[model samples]
Target: MWFKHLIFYRFTQPFTLTADELEEKLTAKCFKPCGSQDISTYGWVPPLGRHGDMLTHSAGDFIIITARKEEKILPASVIRDALDEKIETIEQEQNRKVASKEKKLLKDDILMTLLPRAFTRHQTISAYIDRQEGWLIVDASSHNKAEELTSCLRDSIGSLPVINPPVKNAPSHFMTQWLSPKAVLPVPFALGDECELREPGDEGGQIKASKQELTAEEITGHLDAGKQVSKLALSWDDALTFVLGDDLVIRKLKFTEVIQDQLDAINAETAAEQFDADFSVMTLTLRKLLTDLINALGGEIDEASRGEYIEKKILEVSKKQQTAEETAQETA
Candidate 1:
């Protein structure tokens, strides 16, 4: 499936597991329907759903996986009304106010009572592992949801040595540079009519513009007043369009007509075949887009340097912990 957003992580160490090995590990956590009284469940699922039975779908060098989550839908208002009624009844009958701790226990009991009857909602997030690129790209709009899939994968595979890959330049800084008075964006990158600018400081003001020329006097005026671009929409080679954030998260990703034309050319006969074609073409296009985008943003931090940086940070933390322990001992 085409991902509408991307939150990618880079593997610190080499990803050596083959598709079959991964499928075996994932099978241990295959998705199952939530049980009565269960609030939520998370597990692996087939990438192609009913069209394909395999837990992992391999396209070229990339392997695709899906995580399914199911949660009961218990409204806060309903719970509040129920709790109020019960609390009022207990207080009236016992002639005393319910304590905070007692109220918490009552709420827990109420949840258990209502969970089995509550309607359920389901969502699935898909991700692809690029072994050669050492990237785990998730189709999630938020970092929290993306981490849910990675957390499940870590539990399945024992460990996942992945990090939010670092880049040489800050995304916001570089993006702001591109829109500066004398700057020019890299080849094939053209500005779209949307951006968010924020002033510098904790309490700084922010503004958003949509469907307006980014080079307009009003926008550059914000930059002149010491504001930075936090989010900017841009297109790549007429193939893909997306909004890049200061945090390097890609949002509102759209594969353009160029990509669609390629898919249309495939014209696969079966549903499974179409799905396969879409995944293959989309992944390939995305790979190219990532490559160019990274270069334009001054490239990714190489693995060796990233490893060294991580080691230094870990050592610093360890020293701080040791110092804290010594202080505690002295105080004791």
Candidate 2:
């Protein structure tokens, strides 16, 4: 299946687990339906859904996995109504007001009682570990969901050494620069018609524009006024289109006709065959896209470079603080 959103992490060290080893580890946390009283249950599932029995699907050097989470849906209004009735009944019987502490306990008890009857919903997060590339790209729009999958993997396999990919330059800075007048975008990257711009600083407001020329005078006017691009829509070599955020999250991904034509040529009939073909194509395309993107944004900061960068930043901050303290002393 195609991922709608991507939140990827870089492995600090090489991932060494073989496909069989990883599969065995994941089985210990195989997904199960939520119990009657359980509020939520999360575990690994077969990436091929009902088409295959293996929880981990190996495509060359990539190992694809899926995590399923089933959670009970207890409406807040219903819970509030139930809690109110219970509290009223208790108050009438005892002739005393309920304290905040007791109200919390009552809420917990209400949840426990409601969970069994509450409707349950299920969602799955699919991700792949590109052992060759040292990246774990999750099909989740939010960081929390990506973390959930990574946490489960850590719990299953004992250790997961990954971090958000560090960059040599801020993405916002480069993205804004890309839209400036006479600025040429990097190879394979062409601007689209959507972008989000925001003023600098914590209190700065933001503006979102769609179906408008990103490099037009009207948009450049805002950039001249000190706003920076926070989210930008762009296409990579006409293969994929996506919105790139300042945090490096990719959203609103769409595959172009070129990719669709490739899939069509596969002429796969079965569900499993189609899935395998899609996975292979998607992963290969993504590897190239990510490589070009990282290079365009001034490349990823490796561990050694990151350590030096952090140290330099710390010293700069210390120097500024010292200067401020000296100024304060002089003023006093």
Best prediction by TM-score: 1
Which candidate achieves the best lDDT against the true structure? 2
After superposing candidate 1, which stretches have Cα over 4 Å from the reference? Answer: 302-304, 312-332
lDDT by residue (117-206, candidate 2, tens digit) is: 899999999999999999999999898798789889999999987777778899999999999989999998999999999999989999
Output the TM-score of candidate 2: 0.91
lDDT of 2 at 141: 87
Tell me the spans in candidate 2 whose CA falls farther than 4 Å from its real position: 308-332
Clashing residue pairs in candidate 1 are: none
Residue 282, candidate 1: alpha-carbon lDDT: 84
Residues 200-309, candidate 1: write the lDDT tens digits. 88899999999998988899999999999999999999988899999889999998889888988897999889988999998888888788888999987775787786
* Each prediction's TM-score versus the true structure: 0.91, 0.91
| Position 117, candidate 2: lDDT | 88
Model 2 has an lDDT value of: 0.92
